[model samples]
Target: MRPSTQIKPISLLKTQTAQVIRRVCEDREPLIITQNGEAKAVILDIQSYEDQQDTVALLKILALGSRQIAAGEVKPAGEVFERLRKLER
Candidate 1:
């Protein structure tokens, strides 16, 4: 949670949608939208949202690699590189 300025009630959001959106985009910070005093939604700038998605996708790939290693479903790096080099020929 941030200061009161960064948090807006659903009513205010409806009335001041443009300003709220502008603030979030310019500040590069998420705006917390609340209903009944409970946080309900977030407004994130496009770049931050895309970056988060990219990071999550990378984490998924890393997790898959870890699981493969633990299950011994792996190949030798030398063999893999040799196959790549031959493919490049």
Candidate 2:
């Protein structure tokens, strides 16, 4: 978060929606939308949102791999590579 970033009220969002959208896209930062001085929602550009989703998906995959390893459901790297090579043939 930037030092200059401020929480915007819902009223301001309703009135200056276009400006908010433009700023979010240009800055690639999420805007905190507030209501009654309470944080309510977040506004993000499409690309940033997609990037966040991708990052979360990758984290989930890493966690799953760790769990599998802990459960002893793992294989040797060399054997996995050999199977892949056979599949490529």
TM-score (all chains, Cα) for each model: 0.88, 0.86
| Tens-digit per-residue lDDT, 1-89, candidate 1 | 36677788999889988988888889988888899999999889999899999999999999999999999999999999999999999
State residue 70's C-alpha deviation in candidate 2, in Å.
0.6
Off by over 4 Å in 1: 1-5
Model 1 RMSD in angstroms: 1.7
Clashing pairs in 2: none
Candidate 2 local lDDT, residue 53:
99
- lDDT per residue as tens, model 2, 1-89: 77347578899889998998999899888899889988999998999999999999999999999999999999999999999999999
* Model 2 stretches astray by more than 4 angstroms: 85-89
